[model samples]
Target: MRLARTLRFDQSDENVFERAAQPDEWAVSGAFEFSNWSEDDLSGKRRQAFANGWLGLESFGRATFVATAKIEEQEYRALVERLAAHFVEAWGAPDLETARPVAEKELAFMAGLCDEHEPNTLLIVERSLVTSGVSESFRAIAPQEATLDLVAVHVTSDD
Candidate 1:
């Protein structure tokens, strides 16, 4: 199945996020984290995260970008289990049994987001507070040719 994983082009995320997700960690939209929050609740790094960060499933950290990638069934199930536990611990869900379905739905939505995008296409999420709740829109950045090769392979001598 296709899913999204954290992607980092530079170290700027370290300064922008409270905790920056390591590259390649699984990611989700994470809008649920702000379900009970308001404008006042977001400040500084927290606000940055709400603005344009993808939630890393493993670290509970934030990433500026995520790339569509493939995931196996076993890894997916483990992610479900981890997120279910997080719901219980972080959101006060009754238990894993109750949280499991909700966690699955979140991951399923994330997977669906990746369905149309090709593998390695980077995605960014922009979130805002709507009257009823949070609103999110996604933007996709297509991959480019390996430009790094020019710097690595073609060095010119000084004139």
Candidate 2:
């Protein structure tokens, strides 16, 4: 039977690096916030000055996950769409033979966003797996400084 589980970061007492290295064994899936940044604007410059921070699942096996900020609502929506496509292309039915398309699409989508909001986002990437007699699970990683919280729910066949 498959089982689902959720783990909440003990905000009162936990470190991000340590958590990243070794999350709770019982946790199958989880999410958390990371970091932040700020910068001053320069009137004379042609570009806007900005700074930001982020935290999320870094690497899952050979795949590396990354996320950035979204300045406008339109951009945010586009980002979500792109992310979905990325997942589909990277690990969906009828999988592509190459990862180039997924990478290109993701980069192009990101290029359209504002630089100021790029650093303050979360990204998750993982490899595909199959389960039969065992159970299925999900895992999420995030930074502690991001100030975001996640609530995970576990599911089981008996439940």
Task: Choose the strongest candidate by lDDT.
Answer: 1
Tens digit per residue, CA lDDT, model 2, 53-107: 1112222111122334333556434433444444455445244334345434443
The superposed Cα distance between candidate 2 and the true structure at residue 57, in angstroms, equals 13
How does candidate 1 fare on TM-score? 0.91
lDDT of 2 at 99: 39
lDDT of 1 by residue, 1-159 (tens): 899999898999999999999999999999998988898989999999999989998899999999999999999999999999999998999999999999999999999999888888999999999999999999998877677775586657963
Q: Distance (Å) between predicted and true CA of 156, model 1?
A: 13
For the record, the alpha-carbon RMSD of candidate 2 to the native fold, in angstroms, is 19.5
Poorest stretch of ten by lDDT in candidate 1? 150-159
lDDT of 2 at 159: 96
C-alpha lDDT values of all predictions: 0.93, 0.28
Error of 2 at 71 (Å): 2.1
Number of clashes recorded per candidate: 0, 7
